[model samples]
Target chain A: MDKKSLTRRLGRPVLGTVAALAMTAGMLGTGPAKAAESFKIGVVTFLSGGAAESFGVPAWNGGKLLIEALNRGGEVPAPYDKKGFGGMTIEYVLVDEAGGATKQVQEFRNLVQREKVDAVLGYVSSGDCLAVPPVADELKAFLILYDCGTPRVFEEASYTYVFRTAAHAAMDNISLARYMKSKGIEAKYFAGINQDYAWGQDSWADFVASMSVIQPGAKVKTALFPKIFAGQYGTEISALMREKPDLVHSSLWGGDLQAFVLQAGARGLFKRAQVAFSAGDHVIPQLGNKMPDGIILGARGVNGLAAKARPNALTTWFWDAYTKEYKVFPVQAPFRMVQGLLGLKTAVEKAMVANGGKKPNAEELAAAMKGLEWDAPSGRIQMTLGGGHQAIQPNAIGRTKWDTAKGEMTLIDVEYYAAECVNPPDGTKAVDWIKAGFPGAKCK
Target chain B: MTLLRSVPAASALAFAALVLAGFVLPDWAMFLVTMAFAKGLVALGIVGLMRGGLVSFGQGLYFCIGAYVSGLMANWTGITDIFLLSLLGVLAAGAIGTIFGPLLANYRGIFFAMLSLSLSMILYGALSKMTTLGGTDGLNVAAPTFLGYAPEGRPLGLALYLYTSAIVVLVGGLMRGLFNSQRGLIALAIRDNELRIEYLGASVRTAMAINYVIAAVLGGLGGVISGLAIGHVDPEFSFWTTSGEFVFVAILSGYLSIPAVFVGSILLEVVRSFSNLYFPNTWQLALGIFLLLVIVLLPRGLGSLTLRRRKAKEQA
Candidate 1:
């Protein structure tokens, strides 16, 4: 076609399209500005891979429920009675934490820089928790580590913008040891088996340190550390059976814990020794009647089906909502996640009030969260450690009793420990505190 | 003349583009590209082994070694210089490779793959059990200083991207040269007919061992850069699945040009990031389907498309 005819043919349509595009852009741009401001939170947890079934899914579900309830208004008790954070609706962008630490760091940056999230909550792996804090601090973004149990995130490198809402690994082990002492479980020989990774190794070290203080003369017979997600426990169980220590301890969680219990139970290892598990509540619902009776265990805190007995209204609401939605009782993971969200809610609301009910910036949010206190499904979580960057919360420990008729594993002879009894005090390292026989600790 | 012939103009242009990317790309995209380049180097090492008729299911052993060595140096010795750390990482992996190369040279096919996997698993076990190295939680490498200058925040990321890009480009050029050298030809010849090469008075084992060592150094380089960029190293770096990822990327790139390996790695990362964001629960399924499509439609992988286009242009 000739140039003039071609230009004439295309000009009208091109002009029409440009006019439509400009109109659409104007229409779209105004819509978002008029709506109530949204407080964008990046929620990261394991949504796939091995951890998803036990920890990641439950934690993600908990975050989802909490955000939904908060957006709908007045789902939680007083102090959290207002909808959203200071009247701005809470919106979450979920990211998978299934990949290794490197990918997680990249995803975290994407959440902050690309998605423009104001704050981030969630990391189920200690490795991820350790890797992300520095980046978060550098970016000056508010980060709440919900479920990772590492104490090093705070103790090793202090960050102004990073906080862990759950108590560190030391608390779980110390509380369990305290429960054992309170119950008068006399044992001369102690044997422990834990996952070989950081979480497992740290838990075991804390347990041993606490045992030395609580049962000074007790000898450790054998210590086994199988790899994480190893699944097979035949050799380890056989080794434990051979030692036949008076007391056996393990910190295995998720599918690894389930596998170990089933294999050990079949081999009758539970009968030979009084066994104790830190972070054991995850497997109770999965094991049901299969869970051994009278084996001492703790759920990292006062979490899981065990917390259903707590008399708090918020606890009851969370338990009922989670159970009804998931068709299974919430475990330690969900409990930690809820605690994190609750703490975030309190911090945001406080910051909002300080800022005259407008959305708070990262600095204001961090300021508000420092030393914040709030009620959770587990109990009261207080920022009492790590210069107020770490949380200390009370936890319950008890022995398991399998009720065959009910097809459930129940916590019996349950005992609660105040946060001050277990967690390290501010400015003291956990290992150092335990080595010093928990100096200045007040157990009640 | 040989050096000039071996170096492709496209590689030089690509390197320049990557260096420029640091200034223009967003922080997250720059981080993603840096990682993809690092991982792509590991994939190139796997490709090197493939050309020698060898497939390692555990290049992650050397990769992990490089990362851990760099991390340990920073933690124990307080050496935060990236150049020195990179040198130490390469030397450490190369030393291990030299020690194990003789034993590995005797094995081929599935035996080589299994032995590689076994070696990596042993490292994984040891890393998991050693509490001082942070055990399974792994140790963090301090934010590396570039030439003794400490940069923080966006500057640190940009510095890392530039450093990583330069290393990848230099390595790629060296690899291309090796592909055309007498030693490289000898290695490929061994893959085709080891007996014939031996009959020609060439030492097959020595050639294979040399290639293996070279591959180890490349893997180590990739790991060190990655560890520095990410600021953490763990036993998962040596896990069998990690090695499998290298193999997967190598296969996806095909046994073709070095740049194809980088392209393949970048594509994989993009797919993973987007899928994880949009479909968290089904990302794995999404990756699986992508692999299925690639395998079915392009047996020689995405690399063949470039060759096909070139041939078509020549025909026209």
Candidate 2:
């Protein structure tokens, strides 16, 4: 074929294809330009994977219930009575937070850029929580990390659009330690076994620091950090038994916690030491009668069975709604989720009122959330830490009593520590504050 | 020989098309393509290994090494240059592969698979325990610069897409060349009959070791690009499931052409993304069903469709 004919043949098709692609692009660009009638929020949690049953599913369920209640209008109490955010029906894009931090980052971007969600609330993994904030900042999207317990998300970087609605991992351990102190439990030599990850390590560090402050003479005997999700704890349990410390502390959760409890209980490891779990409430229902009696445990906050038995109106509503739908009692994951949605609802409403009942932009929403205080099922959650980007909430720790008649584990002798006592105050890092004997802490 | 010679021109054309796509495609599509290409490079490594009758179940070891090297470099040294970080990642993976290659090359079948898996798990265990690397939370990678120019938002995404496309094309061409080379043939021959290769005075172990190192390099390249693209790296990169995903893509590609790996990766991502969107509760089941369908319909994999068509044309 001659060059002219070849060029004529190829050029026409190429030009036509380019025109078609441009038209398609133009059409797609027009699709999302229409003014949104509903306030879209992206809810990301573990819909699959190992953490799904304990953390991801429950949090997602909580989010679903809250959204349903909010959309139903007047189902929740005042300040959140309006249907959704300022009478705009709440629509959600649910994204699974299973595929690691890298995948979560991509999914986060998709939620903001593609799904065009105004706000995002959910992250069960500390890794994902840490990874997502910068992206949220970059996109100028409002993000509320509901379940991840990492304090480093806010400490590592300053962000206006990113806020964690639940207390950091530090609060759980500090409360557990303080509860022991208040109970006059003698723990001179303490041993700890945590999952070898950020959440576990941070919890252990905080626990040690809090113990040092509360029980000034206490010393760390031995500590074991088994890998996260390590189903087998034979060696670690044996090591803990060999140490034979007066008190054993752990922050392991989900399946790992369940597996450890079963293995340790069978091995009579609990008989040798007064065991304390910083975040063990999630496993109580799963463990049932298998859970040992008189074991001290915390639920990251005043959540699960540890929360007030004669609950307030909001707590009763949330517990009932969640239980009706999921057929299980609300755990820390759901507690955090409910708190996040409630806080988001309040902030969005405030912003909407400021904007004359119009849906607030990301900046307005973030502004409303900063330093905001609201009631949660657990108690009041204040964005007081991380320059009002991280939450500080009261946490309850108590001893577990396995009721054979009920075939369930219940928290008895529950003690609630005020948020100020558990969380590091403004301008002070959690680890630094704890190590410095909780300077200026208001322990009650 | 013809196929080998055509690789460069084909790669250049593909590179141009992808570069154009970077500008034309929407943000989400561009991001998805970038991810698929990055993952495809790892799948390519698995493809190479599979061609030699070896299936690695722990390519994630090298992948995580590359990701961590890039992430740690960005975190500790403030080196945001993608080129420098990727080079370091490749070198790090290659160094680790070289150290372990001799030991790994001696095994085959499930033994080889399990050994590689064990090695990756060891890295996963170590990474999960190391607080300096942020433990399970891992560490964030700073936004990378291109030739000293830092870009953000759309510009950043476009830049990353272009850079990733260029790497994919270059690596694809190199892989094609390797497959056509004498050494590649020797490796394939060893897979079929190691005794014959040994009798012919060619060391099967050395060939296997070389292939292993090359696969490691490819995996590391994928890891670095992905880690940089996603702006985070964690121990999950080295987890067994991560490696299994790569293997799944390799099988889906049927150890076929270089482009097949990319296609397979994209398909997997699409299935995963859409499933997660529509069937949040049963996304895993969706993926399982899709895989079953693909296996049942196209036992050799999705790439077999193209091969079968080509064969039909040749016969006619």
Q: List, residue by residue over B1-316, the lDDT tens digit for candidate 1.
A: 2343448665677788888767877787778888898899888988888888999998999999989888889999999899999999999999999998888989999999999899999999888878878887887788899887999989998998998888888889888889888988888898899999999999989987887898899889889988888888999999999999999999988876777788778778777776677787788898898777566555676576666656677799
lDDT per residue (tens digit) for residues A69-146 in model 2: 888889987656778777888888888888888788878877787778889998888889888888888778999999
First chain TM-score for all predictions: 0.91, 0.91
Q: Tell me model 1's lDDT, rounded to 2 decimals.
A: 0.85
Please give the range of 10 consecutive residues that has the lowest summed lDDT in model 2 chain A: A26-35
Top model by DockQ, which number?
1
lDDT of 1 by residue, A1-444 (tens): 986556444543543353345333322222123245888889999998889988999888887888888889987777677888777888877888987897899889878876778899989999999988888988999999999998898888889999999998898899878877888887799999998778777888898899999999788999998877899999999998898799998999889999999999999998899999988888877888888888898888889866876657888888888888889988889999989988998999889889888889899999999999988888889997889989999888888887778876778899988899898889999999999999988887
> How large is the C-alpha RMSD of every model relative to the true structure?
6.5, 6.0
Chain B TM-scores across candidates: 0.96, 0.97
TM-score of candidate 2 against the unseen true structure? 0.92
What is each predicted model's overall lDDT from 0 to 1? 0.85, 0.85
RMSD of 2: 6.0
Candidate 2 docks at the CAPRI level of acceptable
What is the lDDT, from 0 to 100, of the residue B115 in candidate 2? 98
